[model samples]
Every structure is written in C-alpha cells, then in structure tokens.
Target: MARITMKFGGTSVGSPEAIAQVADIVKHTVDERHEVLVVCSAMSGVTNLLTEGALTAAAGNPTRYQAIATHLREKHSNAIRQLLPSDVERISIRDEVDSLIDEFETLCYGIYVLREASHRVMDKVTSLGERMAMPIISAALRHNGVSSTTISASYLIVTDDQFQNAGVLFDDTERRIRRELVPVLAQRIVPVVTGFLGATRDGVITTLGRGGSDYSAAILGAYVDSDEVWIWTDVDGVMTTDPRVAPDAQVLPVLSYGEVAEMAYFGAKVLHPKTVQPLVDRNIPIRVKNTFNPSFDGTLLTHEEHVTPSTVKAVTAIRDVSMITVAGRGMVGVPGIAARTFAAVAKQNANVLMISQSSSEQSICFIVPEEKSASVVESVQDELAHEYGRQDIQRTWADDDVEIVTVVGAGMRATPGVAARVFGALKEASVNVLAIAHGASDYSLSIVVRAADTERAVQSIHRLVVLNGISPNVHAPEPIKNAVS
Candidate 1:
C-alpha cells in the first residue's frame, strides 16, 4: 500500500459541514489500506480575521484585537461541540484552542505596546489560525471512528529564523519527520498537523509567506517520501486558463514540473510556486484534487517522463501591471547602468517582474505591479537622472492596463514553430502583442497584451496551441490598428 500525505485547504474545513466532508474523504483513503497523514488549514476566512486583529492592535487599540480573538476562540469551540462526541475529546480540543488564542493575544499585546508588527511577530499571530483549526479536525476524525492525532507542525518543521518568509532547513526537517513523525504512522494512526506555520530553532513561530499551507504539505510529503502528495483545494484542478477570465478554459489532466512551475509563476491560482520544489527534488508526483468533488481524477504533476503534448498545455495571465522603460543613447556600453536602475527599484521595495534588455544595451525595461509603479519610477529617475542626464536617460511609465499571457508546455521544446503558432493565433484574434519573451527551455512563451484583451488572448492562444493542432509556421494576418488611442 502506498503511504500518502493529503492536505486540505481552508475552504475544505471551513465549518462543521465542511469538516465532515473532509473526514469522509479521509475515511476512503484509510479504507484503501494506505497509511495516511493529513494536514489542514484554518476554517474559511479565519486567518483573515486573525490578520485584521493584528493590524488593529498595531494601529494602537487592543480592544478589537481581543474581541476578534475571542470570536475566533468561540468559532473553533463551536465546531468542536458540533463534531466531537466524547466529553474528554471536547475538553481537550477546547483547551488546545484556548492555548492558541492565548498565544495570539500575547502577540497582539506586544504589537499594541510596540506600535509595530515585525515579520517574526506577524508569523506568530498568523500561526494561530492553523493551530486552532487542526485540533477540531482531529477530534472530528476520531469521532468518525478514524484513529487520528493532532501533531504540531512547529515541533517537526524546523527552519532558520527568517521570520515571515523563513527558509526550511531540509536536513533537519527530514530528520525530525523520519524520527518523530514516522512512529505515529507506523501505528496506522493518521497525523493531522497544522499547515502554513513552522518554528525557528529557538522555537519562535515563523511563517512561509502567504500561501504557506501549500508549502507545508510539500515539505511533509518530501520528508516522508510519500508515494504521492494530494493537494485538496477549491478548484477542479489546474486549468488551461483562469476560468473566470476565459470561460473556454479547460482543465489539463497531466502536467510536467516545468509547465506547472511556469503556470504558477505567471499567476495560476491552483498552487503556490514554492509548493512544487520539494516534490520535484524528491521525484514525488503531486495531484491537485477538488475537495467538493473527491471522485474526479484531478491533474497530476510529474517530472518529464514523456514529451509534453505538442499543443499548448495552458494559458496564464496576470493584470494590474505597469511597464517602465529606461532608454537613452547614453546607456549604450555604460557599465553599472543596469545595476544602478535595479538597485534603485529594490530600494523602494518594488518587485521587478519581467525584465528585457536590448541587444545594443541602449535600453532596459521592466514591469512592476501597478501599486508600486510611481515609487519605482521616482526611484529610477532620482538614481539615473544625473549620470545620463534627464534627457540622456529617458524614463517613461505606461499606465495602460497590461496583462502578461504565458503559453506553457514541455512539448514546445521539441516542436518547431510553437512561438510562431502562439503569435499567429493572437494576431488572427487581433490581439496586439507588445514585448515577448521566451527562455532556452522552450517550455513557455510570455507576451504583454492589453488588459481588455487578456481573456481573448488566453482563449485564442489556448485554442490555437492546445485544442487545434496548428503549426507555428502558419501565416498570421496583419496587425490590427490601435483604435483605443
């Protein structure tokens, strides 16, 4: 029997009803004779409440934070009362929930007094969500006649003290899981741990960033060397495009690691970017399943065992981006010009998304999220205005809504004309292609398109590259004139 690790997201265990649904899924897995380990996120919207509490406390009042904490405590206790049968189980679950709330209040009090929320303290506060949710889930599973134990992830998943975005120490984490967690699995008992929160060497709470629950599952799956890691989420699986944006978007049955990585980086909402690394390193396949539809065969992500399909595997895009241009004749052969421009952006904490440099070294262009566009432009102007002069180093910021559309497929590398086919389809659809970028891997082709045409662009690319077997050399019609300007 294959030993597997299954993780359910917040929506999967949002309430007593949802918890029962998850318990049913677990029962099926256990009945199949596979040793199972399950990890669960907080109830739907619980983490957000905890975050709001911290923000309120940091803004100078602890009253609202304390009230929110109490509300959260009541929410979990209510779930336990509805789900657990034995009085002992109910008390044990309540006490664990209370301890988590106590920790949260302690952190809020610190934030109120200091009038600040450091990443370390934020991690601690955010962790309470999972800590409060997992015990209720474990108790529910036990009441359902499945032997389950609540294991604290902070005790097993050890990382360096990087606070909000702590990096995992794999050797230490793997050792702890093998030595400490394996014993429980050996007894055929399911270990239900809280996802998204880990601890530093000194036992201080640290998080793995916003979508850390996905990362938590990947880490545990790798440590145990499980046969497969199943990520239970709200979506059906990884789709060819965002269903909301492109109604024609279809779900892909299989994907390679490279394809999945590209889709995640370019804004596929199925899984976090970091969640695939451990699976890739350990050669474990990952399945993205829907919590609501447990019977469907969801998408499977595996290493390249065979060539990717010739058609485009998926289309991904993200909106609300601003493109910045740094161009000047003086930039030609100017050493440290690129370095200075990037350093300036970094100083303002603006994330550089896509960067393209001209072969002549005369211009460097990058895209940043719309919110940081102004700050980034000012930082660049201040840093480069003197060296190349205002005119010499021309700076222009385009507020024209832009969307990044990427076509992902491992088959593109072997197929000649994949890029030509994608561009050809977009051209046929009259979708204006701005800057285009492709790497040596040939797994993806990214293009800048107008936000208005984002959905059409993805649908067109999906049809041309994925559904219809069109050749890259297929001739595309002439470009459409810009009427919006």
Candidate 2:
C-alpha cells in the first residue's frame, strides 16, 4: 500500500460543501489502499478572525473580542452541523469545539486585562483555529465511513520556544511521531492532524508562520517516510506566472525543487517559503493539486524536473516592493559598509528580495517590501550618520513604486542565451529595467522595474520565453508600439 500525506488549505474545506468534498477525497484515497495522513488549516478566514480578536483585546478592547468569539463560535457550529451526520457525532464534536473556543476566549480576556499580547500569547490564541478545525474534519471522515481520529500536531511535532514562528526540531519531532503516531497509523486508522501548529518541548503552543499548514504536511510526510506528499490548494497547480498579472500565464506540469524555491522566494502564492525543505531532504516528491479540480493531475516537483523545450518555465512578480540603494564614491573599497548596511536592515527584520551591486563596488541596491522600507531607510541612515555628514556616503534612499519580476526554469541552467532572450523581450516591450540579478544557479533571473510596467513586462516575457521558446537564431516578435508607455 502506498503511504501518502495529503494536506488541505483553508479554501479546500471552507464550508460544509467543501468539507464534504474533502471527505470524499479522503475516502477515495483510502479505498485505493493508500495509508493517508491528513493535515488541514483552519477554515477560511477563521485564523484572521482569531488574530484580530487577540489584537483587539490587546488594544484595550476586550468587549470587542467577545463579539468576534461569538461569530467564530457560530461559524464552527454551523460547519460541524453541516458535516457530521448523526446527533451523537454532532453533540460530541460540538462539545469539543466549544471547549476549544472557550480556551481561545480566555486567552483574549487575558490579553484585554493586561492590555498586551505577547507573541507567546498570540501563538496560543491563533493556534485555536487549527485546533477547532481538526474535530470537524475528523468527524466528517468518520461520517464518510472512514475510521479517523483527530490528532493534535502539538503533541507530535516538537519545536523550539519561538512562539509566533517556531522552527521544527527534526530529531525530537521524528522520534515523537514514531512513538505517538506510528502505532495509530498501523492500526489502519487515518490521523486527521491540525496543520500550522506545533508545541515546544514543554508543551507551549506555537505556530510555523502563515501558510505553515503546507510546512506541517511536508514535515509529517517526511517523518512517516511517505512516498509522496500532496498539497491541495485552490489553484490547479503552479502557474507560469500569476494569471492576474499576465493573462497568458499557463500552468507548469512539473518543476524542480530549485525552480519552485525561486518562485516561492519571489512571492509565489502556491507554497509556503519553508514547505519544501523537509521533503527535499527526504527526496520525496511533492504534488500540488486542486481540491476544486481533483481530476487534473496538477503539478509535480522533484529533484529532476521535467525538461521543457522552453528555457523559461514561469515569470512571476512581487508587487508593492521598494528598491533601496546605498551609494558612495568614497566607499568604493569600503570594507565594513556593506555589513553595516545589512545590519541595520536586519534590525528591522526586513527581507531583502533581489540584490545587485556595482562591479566597481561604488553602490549597492536591493528590494524589500514597501511597508518596511521607511523603517529600513531610517535605520540605515542612523548607522551611517557620520558618512552622510562627511559626504563619504552619497545617499541611501528607497523608491516605493517598484516591483520584482523573476523568470524561473531549471532548463535555463543548461541553456545558452536565456538571459539575452529575457532582456530582449523586455526591451521589445519597452519595460524599463531598473536593476537585474541572475541567481548563481542560473535557474532563475530577476529584474526590478517600475510597478506600472510589471504586467506588461511579465506578459511579454511569458509570450517570448514560455510560448515561443525563443529558439536559437530566432527572435521574439518586435515590441508592441509604445505598449509599456
């Protein structure tokens, strides 16, 4: 029998109908003689509501949290009623759900009384969404005639004390899974596990960050030594680019681990940033499928990606980003400026997206989320205050009206002239490139451009590299007349 771990995002089980559909998927997997371990996120929007409640209570408005609690209670109550078949199951599930809700409410009340919500308390509060979801999903599976038990990942997956974004402790987690969960799976019982949550060794609640549900699934799949891990989300599979930005974007049938990693780093919505590491370590293939369209095989990711005729597999963009440039003629051979510049950014916890430096070492530039740019600039200026006063450092400034566009394909590593073709496409489309960075692996290249030119740039790149392949001795069609203007 095949041992497989299947994970569903919130949208997959957003409502009664959706939960019913998920139960059907589980039933079908079991009937095929596969050992299925399920991981699920909270119902759609539930976690946000829980987070808002915690923040509101922390803002000295505990009464507002009560209204949120009531709404959440009603939401889960309705889901349980729609999913469970008999009154016996309904009553049992209701009691468990209500108890968990009470725990959530109590946490909010504590935050209100203290007028503060630490990351630790927020972790405990936010985790209640997944805790509340597992019971309904487990009961739904049983109603479908599948013997399933709701298992708390907090008991199986062990992590460090990082409350809001904990890192999984692999050795301890693997050992705990073997001791606590293997026996249950061996009994032919499916374990419906909560996703996005784990606990410290001392049993303090913690999360793996947003979209950690996928990370949870990857972890469990590796622990079980499963043959494959499938992530069921709303989209059919990983797309060449976000369709919203490029209408011509197409779904990639397969990808390499590296290719998807680049996409994830540049803000692809398909997988969590940390989701692929565990499975990659175990050499397990991950399949991205759509719960809404189960008939499609979706996309598969493995070490050896499918070799496409095209050198570029996908073009994706990250919007609402700012580019920060640090330039100084006097610091051309500076030893500590780069280190000091990044140190300031690190203090703000800002993520650097794409980085480019002048060969002369006279200037350095990188992209970060627009929201964090102001703080990042302030910190850098403070760090280099003396240099600025002496005019040794020319300027450190941020441009908030920019985006990062990346083109990814494992084929690009082995192909020649891929970068030429990418730039040619952009040039033809009249999209001004502010900066460019080619990854060391050669699997991907990124360009920073004005936000207004993003869609045009992505569409043009997709049409040239993806659709036409830009074969040797052939060039993409000439740029549309003033298309980017």
Candidate 3:
C-alpha cells in the first residue's frame, strides 16, 4: 500500500470505452488500498485536430477552426453525458469542457487576425486536449464510485517561460506541488491530473515538448515523493527492440536508469528521456505497463539495477537520418569554428542529431534528418564564408539512406565484449557500419548504417546480441613494439 502516480497516453484514453478501461485499472489500484494519482493525455486525434484547426485559421479561414472546436467540444460533452448519470455532475463536466473550448476559439481568432503562430499562443492552443480529457476521465471514475477529482496539470507543474520544451524549475515546482497535493493525498481523494502541460509563474501555458505526458508523470511522482510512477501505454512494455521491425524483439523485465535513458535517446518509444531525469535524481522507480493488460507485471526501471548475465535488454533504431561532415584545413586551429557552425545550423531550426569531432580539430561531423540536409549544408557554408572569409571550408553530406541502430542493456556495462558482438552480428549480415558512437557508460552502443539495410541490421544484431546471448570473440594481445620507430 504505497502512493503511486499513473499516467495514460492518448490511445489509452481515446474514447469512452478507452476511458472506462483506464477507470477499471484505477479502481483496482485504489481497491488495493494504494493512493493512486491518475494523469491522462487527450483522446486520440484530438490534439492533431486542434493543430489542424490552428493551421487552417492561420491560413486566413476561421470557420474551420470554429467548426473543429465545436465538434470537439460536443464530442467531450457527449462522452460526459454518456458516462455520468448524475445531472449535476454531467452539467459540471460539460461546463468545464465548454470553457476550455471557448479558450480555443479565442486563440483561433488570434491566429486568424495575426496570421502567425507564436510558441506561447500555441502552447495555450494545444493544452485544450488535456484540459478536455481530465474532466471526462474524472467523471468516469466517479461514475464507477471511485473518489476522483480532475486537476489541471498547469496549476501543478510549474515551468519557465520557454513555451515548448520548457525547463522545469524543480525547486519551485516541487514546493508548490507538495504543498497543494499533500492535502488531497491525505484525504485519499484521487487527483486525476492532465499530463503534458504546465504553466509559468505568471500563469502562461507551456508544454514539455514532445512526449511531455511521460515527463509530467515523472515530475509529479518526484515532487510528491511517491514510491513509484507507472506509465500505462498501448505497448506491453519496453521491448528488447522495436517489435515492428524485429519480430523477435522481447520485453525487458527490468532495466537500469542508464539503460533506459540510452534506449529513450536512441529511439525507444516507451519512455521519454526528460521523464527519467527527475526519477533518477530522486531515485524513484518507474514501471511501464500496458493499459489493457492490467495483470501483467510491466518492466521496472531503477537506479543501478543489476542485469542478468549474457542477456540483451532491447534493440532500438531510428531511420531516415542524414550524416553531414564539415572538414577543412582552416578548422585545424580554429577556436570558435565549432560554435559558429552549430549556431548556423540552429538558426535554420535544424536539429543536430549526433556530433563527432576529430582529435586534430580538422573536421567535425553531425547527423540530421534527410529533409534538412541541404538547408543545413547551405547554412553552414554561408556562416563559414561570412565569418571567416574562408572558401576552404568543405561540406559533404552522406547517406540520406542511413539509420541509427542502438542496443541497450545494463549488463553490457559490466560484461566485456558487448561492442564486439554487436559489430560481429552486423558483419555476419554484410551490413556496413558507417560510424560508431559509444559513451563511457558502456550501457549502449550506436551505429549508423544505410537506411535500406536498417531492418536487416536490426534483425541480425537482435539474433546475435539478444537471442544467442553470446559475446563476440576477442583477439589475443599484440606484442609491445620498440620505441625506435
């Protein structure tokens, strides 16, 4: 009987039927005498619809945005009507949902007149999804006789003014959340809060960027000092690899914080990288569970957890990446050349995926998505020519045909020969490793290969590192050479 925070994603609570499924899970946890905090994403397609409405309005047509908001409002009102029998309760939920939609209309009107999308305005516009969702979920829980109250996460999770991907001010957020939420927990009233949204100190809406819901749950879990945070998604658990590409990808029973962080960074979709930091700092464990499979024990993540011998936890990959290399003689002794290069790329709104620099400082390499490669190259060249007046800076882009494959496991850190085994498997499949990057942590290794060969590379590596549980063979040490050379 411990306090826990459980967050469900969009697909998990997309409809009345889905909300009912989540209510059932919450009821069970509450029945077990554990204090449960439920967080929910907007229903499926709701956010996308809202975004489309914003885009349409920005194109100088307000009717579509209005129509979409009205339709979405009616959808939630209908769900509440169907799920809640009490007239008073139904009216309350309906009013709350209407107010949120009204706010959306106001935002749409701004977009229509201004014809531009600002980050702060977009944050407010997008937050309506969670705003509409929390009430319906709370009403469903109540209809099922569970004591639950819907709380807007914006009021709880405080962040800076950076509208999207805002960095959380932990001390301030923790103080406020703990002060406000402790009383509710004491009364055993389940607070069903919205995830993926937060507010600044001045009451401006902000978001946690992509996959913010997971971060929301982790932040709340850390602030409340809860024993565990459960992220209930559509998947069974974190798999050894993305099961879609690699059919034999298996679920990892348990993973260390380092292992999970690496996978999340390299392309595992189960948890967000930002979510893990709060939990890791506080030593709070996270459990990844399937909303549909309530009885299954999901994968557990903790700090420094031991790994089983000869086991690979999961394989993950991200495709359609382009590697960009900048090499020139002028770069050899340059001090701020790297900074200028990255600044130019950032100015183009291009994301720098992975960066590698030569020891001699003569070259620097980075990866970006294929779509941005040309623009990135132009931006880098222009910046170099403008800043240094050097035409010698050479730019080359490679393999818009590449994917980054990563294999993650805690055991890999303590177990020798994991890297050798990974490369050996790729060798067996005749997959060429374009570039390799591994950190000192040794929990994971990443390699870039041609996009066409991604599936084969994943399958081959999965077989060698995961199924066979065999490390690659190592060569004997070479004899020491004389200093005469």
Candidate 4:
C-alpha cells in the first residue's frame, strides 16, 4: 500500500458538501489499503474573516469582532449539524466549536484593549481557523466509518519564532511528525492534521505566511518519506497563464519540479518556491488535483523532465510591483553600492522580487511590492544620503507603474533563440521593455514593462509558450471552467 499525504485546500473543505467529499476521498484511500495522512486548510473565507475581525477590534470596534465570532459560530455549527446526523454527535461537536469561538472572541477583545494588531497576535487569531476545521473534518470521517483522529500541527510541526512567517526546524519537525503520525497509521487510522501552523521551542503559536498550507503539506510528506503528495485545490491544475489574461490559456498536465519552482519563484500564485523546495530535494512527485474532479489527474510534478519540444513552458507576471533604480557615474566600480543598497531595503523588511544590474556597474535595479515601494525608497534615500553628497549616487528612485512578466522553461537552457523570440513578441506587441533579468539557471526570462501593458505583455509571452510547447501535451488536463466542481 502506498503511503500518501493528501492536502485539501480551503475551498476543498469549505462547506458541508465539500467536507463530505473530503471524507469520501479519505475513505476510498483507506479502503484501498493505503496509509493516508490528511492535511487540511481552514474553511474558505474563515481566515480572512478572522483577520478582518482582528483589525476591526484594533480599530476600536469590539462589536464587529463579536459579530465575526457569531458568524463563525453559525458557520461551523451548521457544518457539524449537516455532516453529523446523530443528535448527540452534533451537540457535542457544536460545544467544541463554540469553545473555539469563545477563545477567538477573547483574543479579539485583547486586541481591542491593546489598540494595535501585532504579528504575534495576528498569527494567533488566524490560526484558530485550522484549529476549528480539524475536529469537524475528523468527525465527518468517523461518520463515514473510517477511523480518523484530529491533530493540531503545532504538536507535529516545529518551527522558529518568526510569528507570521515561521521557518520550519526540519530535523526536530521530522522527529515529531513520525513520532506522532506513525502509530496512528499503524493502527489503520487516518490522521487529519491542521495545516499552516506550527509552534516554537517555547510552545508559542506561529503561522507559516499566508497560503502556507501547501508548504506545510510538502514538509510533512518529505519528513514522513511518503510515496506522494496530492495538493487538492479548486483549480484543475497549474494553467499556462492566468486564463483571465490569455483566453487560450490551458492547464498543464505535467510539470517538472524545476519548472514549477521557477514559476513559483518568478510569481505564479498557484504554487510558491518554498512549497515545492522540500519535494524537489527529496525527488518526490506532487499531483495538483481538483477535489471536485478526482477522476482527472490534474498535474503530475516529477523530478524527471517531460520530453517535450517546448522551449518555454509558462508565462507569468508579477503584477502590482514597483521597480527601484540606483545609478550614478561615480558608482561604477563601487564595491558596496549593490551590497549596501540591498542591506538598506532588507532593513525596511522589503522583499526584492527581481534584481538586475547594469554591466558597467553604474546602476542597480530591483523590484519590490508596490505597497512597500515608498518606504523602501525613503529608507534607501536616507541610508545613501552621504553617497548623494559625494556625487557617487546621483539618483535613487522607484517606478510605480511597472510589472515583471517572466517566461519560465528548463528547455530554454539548451534551446537557442528563445530570448530573441521573447523580446520579439514584446516588440511585436508594441510593448516597451523597461528592464530585464534572467537567472543563471536559465529557467526564466523576466522583463519590466508599464503596468498598462501587463495584459498585452502576458498575452504575448503566453502565445510563445503555446506556439513552442502546447501542441505535444499528451496528457490533456481539463479546462478551468468545467473542471470538476
């Protein structure tokens, strides 16, 4: 029997019907004699509501948080009543749900008292979503006659104390996971664990950043040495591009870990680089499936490359980002201009999504989220003020209206003329290239263009992936519109 870790996303377990489907899938897997471990995200929209409730409380609206708590109470209680038919079971589950909601109300009240929402407080508030979900899902599985138990990831995942974005302490985390999960699986019981949260050495709750449930799954799958990981989400699979931008965009049936890693790193939201890093290291395969469409094998990501003639697999745009440039004649041959510039941005807690420097070393350019652009510029300006006086740094500025359109494919490493085709497409579309960056791995080509040109630019590069690659996609994936539920 294959040991599999199935991770259900928020929408997959969002409603009573959704949780019922999740229970059926687990039962099927267990009936097939496979040792299954299920990881689940919070019900859809619950985390967002929790976040809003916290912010509203901090804004001095205790009533809004109370309203949020009530909404949550109704939501979870309704799911329990619908999923568990026995009156005794339903009442017992509602009490558990109410207790969790009471804890949420208390924490939000604490935030109202403080009048400020700190990262630590935010993590705690957001974590309750998953904590509330596990018990309900486990109860559903039991109702289906599948032996199952609920587990909080805080007991299984060991991480650092970085409140909102804790990094996993892999060695300790692996030890805890096997110690906790193995015995349950040995007893032929499925262990339903909470996703997206962990605890520090001191036992303080911490969350892996937003959309970290996938990362949590990858880590657990790797640590337990599972045969495969199935990421069950709402989408059919990884699409060629955001179909909203390109009408012809199709779901990719197969992708290499390297290709998806580049896509995630460059800005495709379906998966993030950290989510796949562990799977890549362990050479484990991941199947991105639709909980709604279990019959279709959404997308199989493996270590071995797909032998296709496509030079570029996918085109993505990191939208709503701004670019900053530091340039001066005196900055040429300056040893610390690049180093010092980044250090200053890092001090502001700004993430540099892309970096490109002039060959002459006279200028350095990087991309940061638009929201953090102003603060980054102000911080860099202050830190490099002395250089400005010396005329070594004549200008340090940011371009607010830019987007990074990146085309990724491992095939580009061996294929010649791919770069020419990319720029040629942009030129053909009459889109101006503001700047460009290509990694040493030769997996992706990124170009900066005006925000107004984002749609046109994304369409252009995506057309290239189609002309170069889609013809040979032997394992066809379903269209997003008709994909399962």
> Which candidate do you rate higher for lDDT, 2 or 4?
4
| Every model's TM-score | 0.91, 0.94, 0.90, 0.94
CA error at residue 472 for candidate 2, angstroms: 19
The local distance difference test score of each candidate is: 0.81, 0.86, 0.81, 0.86
In terms of lDDT, which candidate is strongest?
A: 4
User: Per-candidate RMSD vs. true structure?
Assistant: 7.7, 6.6, 8.9, 3.0
Off by over 4 Å in 1: 305-310, 396-400, 469-485
Which residue pairs show collisions in model 1? 312-465
**Cα displacement (Å) at residue 117, model 1:** 1.8
For TM-score, candidate 3 versus 4, the one ahead is 4
* Model 2 C-alpha lDDT per residue in residues 1-485, reported as the tens digit of each score: 77888999999988988998889888887877778899999999999999999999989887878998899889989998888769998998999999988998899889998999999998998889889989899899999999899889999889999888898999999999888777777887999999999999999989998668999999998998888888988988898888887777666777789888888887788675578989998899888888988767778888886556677888888988899999989888768999999999999999998889999988899998899999999999999999899888989999998999988887676787888889999998999999999857667889999999988899999988777753343221221111111
What tens-digit string does per-residue lDDT give for candidate 3 at 237-339?
7887878888887666677888888888788786767778888998988888788876667677878555544546677888767888888776788688889
- In model 4, the runs with Cα more than 4 Å from the true position are 471-485
Candidate 4 is scored at a TM of 0.94
Query: On residues 1-485, what C-alpha lDDT tens digit does candidate 1 reach at each position?
Result: 77788999999999888899888888777777777889889899998998898889999987999899878888888888889878997998899889989888988998999999888778888888888888888888888878999888999899899888889988888899898778888898989998998898888888888578989999988888888888898877788777776677766777778878778878888676688889899898888878888766677788853344455777888778888888888777778998998999999898876877789887787888888988888888888878655466665565547878888777676778888888888987899977777757557778888889888888888777776642334221211111001
Q: Model 4 — which ten-residue stretch has the worst lDDT? A: 476-485
Ranking by TM-score: 4, 2, 1, 3
| Cα shift from native, residue 399, model 2 (Å) | 1.0
Model 4 lDDT tens row, 250-273: 788888888888888777867787
Prediction 1 global C-alpha lDDT = 0.81
